[model samples]
Target: MKYLALWFFIIGVVLIVFIQFITSQNVKRLTEGNKRLLAEVAIQNRLRLLQNDVLTVESDIRGVVITDDRTHLSNVNDKIESIRREVSALRTDLRGEHAETYITELDTQVGRKIVFSQAILNAYDSKGKEAGEAVINTGRGKVLRDSIVQAVHQLDSIRQYRLNGIISNIENNGARARFMGVGLAIIACLACVLAFLYVVNKGRQQERMIQMLNESEKRIKEGAFIKEQFLANMSHEIRTPMNAILGFTNLLRRSSLTQQQQQYVDYIYSSSQNLLTLINDILDLSKIEAGMMHIEQTPFSLNGLVSSVQVMFADKAQQKGLQLTINVDPSTHDTLSGDPVRLTQVLINLLSNAIKFTERGFVHFEVRCLSQTDDEVVLQFRIKDSGVGIAPEKRKAIFERFQQAEAETTRKFGGTGLGLAIVKQLVDLQGGTIHVESEVGKGSEFIVRLPFRPIQNHTEAFAAPAEAVLNPVRGMRILVAEDNQMNQQLIRHLMRQWQMDHVMVSTGREAVEALRREPFTAVLMDIQMPEMDGYDATQAIRGELRSDVPIIAMTAHAMTGEKERCLSFGMNDYISKPLKEAELYAILQAYFRTADAQPAPAVVNLQYLRELSLGDTEFENAIVRQFIVQVPEELGLLQEAVQAGNKGQIKSIAHGMKSSVAYLGLTERLSPFLHRMEVEAVSGTDENHFQEDYEEVRRVCEQAVIEARALLSTSA
Candidate 1:
């Protein structure tokens, strides 16, 4: 469109130049024709003047016959000669044959008249009487006058013709100029229209493109939001079941069990580990999708990594009666820098799949150093298996999430079909490439190429043979603040097997009560409970009692922000339930170690001391003696507060008693009654709730006192 407009402009400009040239030429021709007409008119006027001169001479001659004046005749002769010259010059200037012929005839006639006048003048001079008589008879003067009139009339006719022709040409040229001007105007209008259409069309196209881009952007944002929500929910759902499996397996491990029971426990533990792996894969995939996954560069052993992968698959390959082989190029350095976790994840996925699919032949891995520079080294790792290889058409789709080669393959070889997808994503995240070469029923080989740079300072060496073992929790008093009976029992049994003592309570109220009556090393608080939750209980203990006891929160909800929320609510640590024993033991060990190292004995076990009152009087008195010996001043303050009916002071004393009772395994003895009393004193509640709780706590404390007394007596 623009090209067409440009061509039109160029053509219009050329036509304008041509029109100006033609108009200029026509103007020049008209100006020359007008000049010629004016010159012809002037020559005709001269001829008229010459005729007048000849007539005047004739009249003079006629008059002079009576009065003979020779001087006048000479003057007339000179005038006639001058008129003849003017006529000849005009004839030469008019350069047309017909006009020249007319001028020549007139000039000849004028010459003849001149000659007659001159002859008369000569006759008068030589033989004046006779010559004059002869010329008067001839009548030459009248004839010459008549001829002059005819010549003048002819010149006027010629001038009129020329003038008419000039007028006609002027009219024609004016019409042509008007026509050209109109054509130019039309072309100008067309150019304007074309330019306007081009601009409008361009603007419309740009607007449509912008609209499409906006729509695409909106859809992309929507997709991202949905994906984020899905990942969050999936993380929670996956982790919930995983926690239960791991926690129960750990609990079962501590029990005295038969061989079959141990196998079942092992199976649960292994299955849980597998589930955890799958969850991690899903998380990695989510991170990759969100563009948040990053590689950690550190020094790791390349040879050791390959060796570890081989060893991981060795047992599985041997169980299937297949040979497993590993080959590493000697040229490759043992230590290189890269993200070992992600790299190991990719290799393990490959090797594990190879071992699982290969039934009888062999599984092998090879590591080769492709090239090396000062800063970077390129390496190729290959895992090959003699198994049911993927079909040609299905190979590409295998790298897509949740997609297998076929339904039969998925069924025969059970998998989430996410391994290869995760491996591909991880490989790409590390700026690496992966490819597979295989033929159906022959074998398959998976290759990965990665680049690594060496770390300047390395702190730890790689160890492949070390197994992750759960750290032992020994002689730690744990306060189990759980409402669920089964969960409480499970925690209690697990703690017992680890040689750690625990006080179990049903509610947050009981947890606070136990904390009040005795000193506890740590509190394993459950988040959701009747009356008060772990959050409120921790708040109360931290606020009123001024206790800084470490509280490890346990919750069933494993949402994205739940762990942070638990920690925010005054919990020293958090563990999601169903709980892993390792997590619990670790938290306990961390807080207990720090607490035990403190110089001062921070708190007393008041409830445990109170429990010894129900046994044999003397033994109970001895236990009291030991208690007073340890914290006599604090006991006096407790006694004073109880007598004064100061509910705040009573709650504080009860909190002290709860912690101490838990340490002595007498939580059941005093916690319930102390909790009821604390609640009544703080809120001024009705006596009914308090009376019932106090009676139960009194009975348990009495029994605990009797038992403690007998044990002390026996020791003595």
Candidate 2:
């Protein structure tokens, strides 16, 4: 290898020397040729200028003679001076050339021409038009100008001949240089080929090593990609069951239970919530590492955001027996355009860390407008905790992934050490800066500065009332396509609680089939399912079924783009797994309350009956008895439709009797089933299985009629 390298270097040096010699020779010749050509061009240009100047003087002299204008005399005098300067310039430029001889002769002729022109101008000035005309008629000025013009032409011709010679020489020199360069290039290329052979033999070992390194790098990248995919899948898998646990726990908390059981449930809820937080931290870290995390800028309320964060940590702070303080500057605008979600995420991570590390002392959070301009607002957030502070050396590493103040800190605190890491990444994504200051055994303070654009003509965001009265529209039926048994049960239980009529399906295929068979007010779709996924199902519902039914994506995948992916596939909105009761209720309220469909009036309009009766008890009783008799037959028909798998008939009967059911004040309980029957009838799916709900509706309706009859009797 050493011998080959030595040989390659020797050949390379020789090749370079040969090529450089040839290139230098060509460059020198081209440079000399360019200089001579420029000189010839300059001489020829001067001769042309002198000729034009003399012609102008002659024309001006004639103009003075003919027009007898003093202005013409001034023009002639000016041109003569210009001719003199041009002649002097030509004399200087053509000093050693053949044009030098003609330049002197040309200079003399130009002087004589100027003398005659001035004589004509003087004639016009001192004598008059007659004398000037007499001088011009004599033809002395014309003769001198003609002589100068001829001399100028001779000079130009001589320069042209010189230029032609220079160009011919340049062409000859270039051709010779090119021929010589070609010969040298051939020799250089031969030497290069031999050098290349020597280098190739030596470089084989290095190339093999480089190839191995590249393969190693590729494997590392693939491993990282696989790890990210595994984490994403694990996130979905874990969130699925976690959702069920938390969702069921929320349901259980609302039910009647013993004090001990309730306490146990609370513990379970808190532990589950913590587990969810840990999972989220891992997923966020994975995304940030994979470069998949993005910051979204949307309009949000600053006051609301801060208050919500305060509320979130308030419980934990109380449990830890530490005071938590949140102070917001009044000067901060309530509405600003920014990624409030990411901002909130970063703040929560910082606050949680602060609260967790601090056991005895208080944790203080403060937000103030550091600066405000017409378009942007810079907010300064400081989270100071009077807990165990970090040592000076460890402060910098705390924000790194999977790092804490020290290894012991992670063991003592029982955290993933990813909070600050995520916090730092999120702040950077938002074009913000975050820093921490700490002294061991005292405390730590984390400060973040973020800039956000101010929202123009922004309306303050209002939180829904805690106990929002949900007057669910009558006959509002929704379709839920959930594959998980627990999730399906959770949704069913919630739907019943809200008195919302809905049908449950196990797959996207079923959801699509159901939609085609019947009309639903909305569809709650789970993303991952058998037979078909939620995205394809939504597309089918939108295209094949041409149904504009709002499809809310219930997904466990909490990746950054999950919501947009669902929305792109025609989902109206989305809610992540382990859905919160408030979010579900809010979604329902937003969908149903805003629907143009009005609520069916309460059971039995007493006012209508009173007006019809005209204070007659017998007429009201007869009316109640007739309604009772007709309802039994309609109920039997509904049962028959369910038995025969006649969805159309069942829907027709449900819609026909909905008014009477409303009149009996049974719409709240019976209306849900009636709405369900109406929706299922259109779906034409598993009609026989729907009898259970139909039977329940029957029982409620019968009991309602009985209660109504007693009311009628008493009122009469």
Candidate 3:
């Protein structure tokens, strides 16, 4: 459009110039004609003057008749010469035919008229009687005047014609210029319209693309949320059954079972292990999808890891009558640090897949050292099997989760097909690469290259050995505060198997009451119970009891933060259930060993001391004396609260007493009866409630007296 406008401006300028040129040319021609006309008018005037001069000369010669007229005739002749010179100049200046012819005719007529006038003057001078006749014969002067006027008229007509032509040319050129300008403007408008439409279309396309992107992002977020929820629920569902199976299997191991029963248990255990692995894989997939997966760096022995993998799969390969070989390059480092767990997972998946697909041929694992630096070592792991290989089309597709090379292969191999996918993700996360080379019915080789940094200080990497057998729990009395009947029974049975005595309570209230009345080694506190959860109960026990008793947390929720939350609430240790007997025993042994080393005070009845005592009289005597010194103040508060009839204060004091007595394992002697008293005090059932609690307290005091007497008798 700009270009067109420029062109129109140029054309307009050109037309203006052309108009000026043509007008100038026509004006020049008209000016020349006007000049000619003016010259003709001057010539005519001169001719008239000459004619008058000749007539006057004729009159002087005819009328005066030479008395004394010599000077007058001479003046007349000079005048006649000047007029002829003026007419000659006019004739010399003429150019065009009209002007030339007019000038020539004028000159001829003038000259003839002058001659005729001179003849008349001569006749008047020489023959005075013939002067009139000479004037009549001379018509040339009048004819010359008429010819000059005709030439002036013709010049005016030509000038007018040139002026009209110039004006017409200017009007024609301006019209053409206006037409060109309009055409150019139309073209520019069209171009602008097209540009605007193009821009609008492009903008629409970009806007549509942006809208699509926003929708896609929204859908992705929604899908991710749904996936996270599903994974959480699925993990819960799978882990619940899995916990029961694994927990019961562990329990069964302690029982005196026949070989057949043991085999059955083993089958269940192995199946549970496999199921747990599958669940873990699914959880991993969910983490990956949710962008929550994280990499952890740890030090591990590369040689030991590879050897373990070989040991795990070699037997399986042999069972299938396939040869399996694991070869590590001599140059490979024995110890390299990395995410050993993830690395092992990937390698196991690769090797397992290799073993699974191989029918008769050998499956080989070759570990080669690529390079080494101060911090990082590069290694290549290749698992090659001469077996039914993946087809060319299916090779890449096999890396997608839940997709195998063929459905038939999936059925025969019996896998979730998530292994390779997980392997790929893990390898990539480690900043490594994996590729597969395969041909159908020939073989497949999966190659992995990894970089790992070794631990800087090897001495710091050593971990103490775990004990093979647990220490025995002697006849220690334990307090079990579990609300569920079955769970309470389970704990009771577990404690009995360890030859330990325990007091079972249904609620935090009952537990506190029992703790006040009896002495036990430690408390097994459940985290989730009605009216009071474990956290609140532990806080109460810690605050009211004022004892650093070991409170092991037992809960079903095994979520990530549950353990920390449990410990943060004053639990000495945390265990998730379905509980493992060994884990529970370990916690018990930890607290019990410390408790046994410190004898209870003398306020605890001698009978309760005897139950906890290991035939050590000095130890028993020392603990009884300590208990005797501490229990009075605590018992005094309980008695005061009971007298005041403040149920809350009573419960608090009784709770403290219960924890102290339970820790001394006096539950069988003191807990049940004190618990009954506490139930009456809190229930406020009747005036007899306080009386009954008082009676129970009196009975406990009498038992303590009897136990103290027995102890003194034994010592004597």
Model 1, 287-395: lDDT tens digits are 7786657787644556545544554555577679988888889877655767776898998999888887887799888899888877988999999999988889988
Candidate 3 residue lDDT tens string, 352-426: 888888888899999998898788899999999998999999989999999899989867877788888888888
- In model 3, which runs have C-alpha deviations exceeding 4 angstroms? 1-179, 190-216, 295-324, 330-338, 358-362, 370-378, 386-394, 428-432, 438-443, 451-716
Q: Provide the lDDT at 357 for model 3.
A: 88
Q: After superposition on all CA atoms, what RMSD does each candidate show versus the true structure?
A: 21.3, 22.2, 22.5
**lDDT (10s digit) by residue, model 2, range 1-716:** 56765676677678678768877887898899899999889767777777777777677677757875666566666777777777777677668866667778888887887777777777777888898888888978767877877887887788788789889998998888788778767766776777787778668978998999999989988987788667757877899999999999988987999999999999999899889999998888888877888776554557656755664576678789998888889888765767766898999888988988887989999999999988989999999999999999998898887888877886788887888889988899899999999998789999999999875431222222111222344566889999999988888898888888999999999999998898887789998899998999999988998887878899888776777788888887788887876556545544553356443322343444445446866655654654554466567667766776656556667765664454334545566777887787777665344688788877666544544544543453
- Candidate 2 clash figure, as a count: 7
lDDT of 1: 0.67
Model 1 poorest ten-residue lDDT run: 463-472
Off by over 4 Å in 2: 1-229, 331-334, 456-472, 593-716
Superior candidate under TM-score, 2 versus 3: 2
Query: What lDDT would each prediction earn against the true structure?
Result: 0.67, 0.76, 0.65
Task: Tell me, by lDDT, which candidate is best.
Answer: 2
lDDT of 3 at 618: 62
